[model samples]
Target: MADLAQSAERFRVIARGKLADPRIQSAIDSSTDRLRSHRVDAWDELGEVEERRSRAYEIRMRAIRDIDGNLERFRTALEARGGHVAVCATAEEANAYVVDVCKRHGAKLVAKSKSMATEEIGLNEALEAAGVTSVETDLGEYVLQLENEHPVHIVAPAIEKTKEDVARIFSKEEGVEVPPVLEEVTASARRQLRQVFFDADVGVTGANFVVAETGTVVTVTNEGNGRLVASLPKVHVVITGIERVVERLDDLPHLLSLLGRSATGQRLTSYTHLVTGPRREGEEDGPEEIHVVFLENGRRNLLDTKYEEMLACIRCGSCLNVCPVYRKTAGEAYGPVYSGPMGAVLTPLLVGIDQAPSLPHASSLCGACTEACPVKIPLHELLLELRRDLVDEHETSWFERLGFSLWSFAWSTTFGYRLSSALARFGHRWASRFGPGRVWASDRELPAFAKKRFRDSR
Candidate 1:
């Protein structure tokens, strides 16, 4: 987390390091390509995909526009169901509330489903520091937890890990030879986590969408671990961003339609858990108590702002699967929980521009992410907006500012443009050997200018 707050220099260095790792690159390529293909096939089969996307966009944007009202309604409805609601303004506040809950319950072990909000708040570390054992129940997350590594992708945390790597990690942990087979490794993880489910004192998860109308926290999972995490434990805690709340229970199917197809290419995830509240009087296995933590953490600040459309994002990770930069550098280069085009725009906004200035410039402005987004966020446009905001704040370096200023001036008039083009044609070879050009040309070849200009030939 400390590293996430460092300067752009760290991003550059880490990106360079990631670019050099062929093994990691291979893993990322395989996972992203497969996911991308799955999404295409799923959308094709679902017919009227564009209409569904439009409806999803409408649902999300409308919900975000009325976020305050929706949040209040959600609080009221959930509280009416005997659930506890804690609205936290910061990560520290959220963590403290969850920790307090754990302490009140004398909780020694916590089982968690996949939740980026928890990752954003460093919940596991906080719990460990408090002498509470927090285990990730999702298989991919469980693997990354064993390695003490963060998720590389939103849906597939261990996307960069191969079967051999999992076998090695599991074998090392269990003190037995685990085969590098998917079935065997999955069984091994299931065997280990099955006990944790029953023994865990508290269950924690992140809401994919919180229905304000019904006070239901919707979690979409393929592995069904989320169901166990929400039900088996005595106490259940949900931590999520305020933007997740929607105005109606009827809005779910429309949103889920896009989320499922875009995220994993399934019509719907295997387990779409709709938990309204804790156990009822006759319920045999559900949690005795439920707590919902609504984390602001800079999300509300985007309302009525240019970046507010960002809140409409359903976190499908479709942008990552198609992002050229992310496919190459992967998530670690972007730093912490979020990554890819969505992260590039959202991270700096959440953490502040100065904290992650490089993220805004990480994209190629290719617009693939915008096209791929389930809710149509115009992610590339947002990246451009962030870059403009960077210049407005003078956060960019003097050299970059000066260079862009010169380029803008040179290209403003035909005479200046012609003069600059002539100089570039004649001096490109020399320029490629120096300063920024040297760094840019280190891996890519500099194309020679043509002997005859198109204008002159015409």
Candidate 2:
């Protein structure tokens, strides 16, 4: 993927195509609206949403501030319970570790639940290259996997796919006719995945929160796939970012209370699996071996920086629900793994500003994401900071720099300001007819310059 700052024409073409598709537009709008409305109602029911958000923010910040110590403590605790821990500092190391694990166990088939961490590292592609068949058990993820696509929303992976689309995908996969009915499509998926659960040599999942105090790996899910994937296979591996750790188990209630409501409007999800370790000696059923891979992947670089607050994010997807840019273009416009307001800030941070120079400019700076965040991350403010960083580093194009410099020079003096204003007023009629103005006016009406100044009248 070429940097959009350098490939503006190509990026605009892709964005325009997505915007022109009515089905894509309708799907994104409906899904985000519903989730946004649900979150508001859920917060209203809580009656203490602000208080809970503040507490959650504090808990997350504390852990991030001392992330090295927290991760060390977590490692010791998990190791005490006979669980193994691997701290990977890059995507390559993480992928290599997971592949080595599969090779060591002689595993051929792996069952996976919804995990954005795995998506970030391209775990599925790595597994396939290593000759492992990784099956997605989550319905939305399964649909996306079959469609050869990645998730669009953090919570709703296949939010753009309708029942009819799903039926077509399922029919192709099953080698049979399937109706577009919800129940039938669901049954068809269940039938195909049931054997996968029994036959998979390993199961992989992502953690919602990791308790440093107890070394518990917590996963929240609406579907029951998370529990099955963890318990059914002989080996269970957890892949997650190091920022997910909280200093204490006591912090769970505050964070958990807001996660479901903010993400999906449920007071709590159907399953909140807290796995301490592998199955005990007398356990009837559970994975015999448990492994936790904590991925840094540029997360450590944010510590002690101005953008450190971003680590407090809990993947609630509340910000994405309210982001105007995301609702219009979806996740593909941002990147493959993360999208929306949080993605706009985190992507550039994780991947370096030079590589993704255009992401910081993806937002409208409306501050809705900050207001909707469960942990109170100032998302819009961080985006503005990123833009400043880009300017300081000279990553922006020469055209942009010249335009801004000219504007600043003009506005800094009364004579230049008056002259520019006069030019703008006189040129207003032709502004929408060509160049950048033409493109801006393609979808939106160009604002008209006022004929008279209020200061003169005063």
Candidate 3:
């Protein structure tokens, strides 16, 4: 996997190339538009959408305020039900714990649900290095795995892929000719993964919410793969961020209402699994050994920071659908596990701003992401905050600092402002002879200066 700097640079190069591709732009526009429409319709159906969002936000705030206490309570309750909990401070520690679990169980094959935490820590890569096969059971995830690609969207991993792209991947994987028909493609994947589910020695999943009150791990998936990955294997391991813990069982309904509506526009997902613990004596189909890994992975550092509201995200992808930047470039452009507006804020915090210096500037700050957020995270404000922090840290180049300094000086006085406007008009006239004002705007002309300033006209 690419490190932060490499990833950000790669995104810049790839995004520029993708911008020239009509097919990519078309696919992104169509997919996000459909998701956006569905989200609006779903919220309308729920009624009192704003009220529910406020309630959910309050619950998230309360839960995060005392996150440490809730985690401890969750551990106590889970252990009482014969479940093991491991609190890992870093990705290496989390991966080590998972590797140890596989080793202890003599696991050769592991089936996995679609979990961004797993992707974040490179779990599959680690498992392969340990001589185990990790299979992605979710259909979208399966397609991505076959293509050797990362997820493009949080909920819809392969949203950027076309049906023909999927057909090619499935055909190559199955060593047979596959049609591009949606139903046919799904059936083929289901047929192939069904046996893997039964044969895998261990199952790995991520929880949507860990109810502290019941010590239950709640997983919501449209596909039944999450259930299979959690239940069919003898050992079931959950890897998730510690921020997923909620204070009460009652809080789940409120969050779920927003999650389902915002994610795929369903009132509720097709499958919602609440696993309290490992199988008891009389229990039949659940895993025999249950282990929950709460990964800190830099999250604890953000608890009291200005960006704590980021923890309120449910990985709905609603922000991505509505974000102007994301719609045009898609998730790959962000070059992180989390993408879009949330990624702009969280990636820098988790990975450090120096590595993703350009991410804060990736937004138009149109506030679409903030408006679409189910928990009402002020994403645009967070982006601005990140930009401010970057400047404070001196992460910006001297050239940018000089330009901003001059611009600030110009705008500070009336004479300077008027003079700057006249200079700007002259600069625009000469811009064509010199070169494009911005590299990305080479094809477009700078707007003509107004005939007269509004203030001067008045």
Candidate 4:
């Protein structure tokens, strides 16, 4: 795994490099712009969008509040339907369980849909280490898999890769001339992946929402690949965060409504599978063995804390689409499986704030992510809380601590405050004469201090 600390330290430099690349900028700009516009249209179509968002938020909150009870109910309901549920408290245990399942099924070729939970636990790397061949069935995931690259976006994994880049990847992998046209490229990928699906002994997927009422694992996808991965293989494994499970079946529609619009701007995904359990005696098509692994990798830690609201996130990439910083740096710069605003709050909390110190400060506190969030997570406020935690722990630099200390002390004293303001005015005037030469001032011009103090004018 990449060292998140090292990656975060170099964030500014990496962002600068990515911003300099016209290809990266163009791809990110166009994709995010289109998604944002579609989301606007989709919300407009759904009359009472805010009301829906509030209802979604309430459902998620209620479910999480009684998470343990919900999980127990979900397990019992799923078991009654002949499905196996494994509650893993750690990533290592989750990966071990999946590997064990694969080994028991004698799985060689494993087809997978786009699963961030699996990525969170490094399941692909674990499977390969255990001598299992895991192939990503999602087109974006397949492209990244072939290139040995991580996802650049949550919903659209290969969002940063251009058609030319994909063509080159295909030509190198398949030993054939592949065109850069979108339709041809997609057809070619489908042709290649169809064989993998046929040969797959086990299929792995992530649930968008798990219904406790019916013991159904719900998955939504634009492509038919998610359906194929779940049904075609003899064995199916679902790895998802515990927060994904909702209490009632009816709660699904509210979340679905939010998820589709917030994620890809569709009223509903092309395919939505509600897998209750393994195939029964009379079943025509389905997996013989269905294993659902509910992963609680640091999620349980946030249950009653100030950060519990983070779990309300539905993994809709809407937050990322509107994040100013994410638009430029993309996902890789965060050095974690999850990225963008959600990642900034999540990765640090999961991996340890010390490991990803710069993540909390990466945002501009513009609240775009808060606005974009389907469940109204208040991501910016959470980020601010994390920053405060860092300061409380004395994790920040001495200079920063001292600067803030001085500011606080000055504000407490009227004379000190007035003197500090006068000094700031004089300094700004003096600095304006030399032009903005500091690195921080490269793109921004420092505003000149007010000609006369407010108090003086009064």
Identify the leading candidate in terms of lDDT: 1
* Residue-level lDDT for 94 in candidate 1: 93
Q: TM-scores of the models, in the given order?
A: 0.98, 0.96, 0.97, 0.96
* lDDT for each candidate structure: 0.91, 0.90, 0.88, 0.89
- Which order, best to worst by TM-score? 1, 3, 2, 4
Q: Which ten residues in a row have the lowest lDDT in candidate 3?
A: 1-10
Residues 1-458 of candidate 2 have per-residue lDDT tens digits of 11212233434555678899999999889989999999999999998877888888889999999999999999999999999999999888998998999999999999999999999899998999999999999999999999889888889989889899999999999999999999999999998899999999999999999999888999999889999999999999999999999999888988888999999999998899999999999899889999999999889899999999999999999999999888887877777878889888988898888877777888899999999999999999999999999999998878779989998999999999988887888776687787766777888877777768665667
Poorly placed runs, candidate 2 (over 4 Å): 1-11
Writing each residue's lDDT as its tens digit, candidate 1 over 332-364 gives 888878889998988888889888989998898
Q: Could you give candidate 4's per-residue lDDT for residues 287-333 as a string of tens digits?
A: 99899999998889999999998998899899999999999888888
Tens digit per residue, CA lDDT, model 3, 63-172? 99999999999999999999999999988899989999999999999999999999888899989999999999999889888878888788888888899988888888
**lDDT (Cα, 0-100) at 230 in candidate 3:** 96
RMSD of 2: 1.9
Q: After superposition, how far is residue 82 of candidate 3 from its true place, in Å?
A: 0.6
Candidate 3 structure lDDT: 0.88
TM-score of 4: 0.96
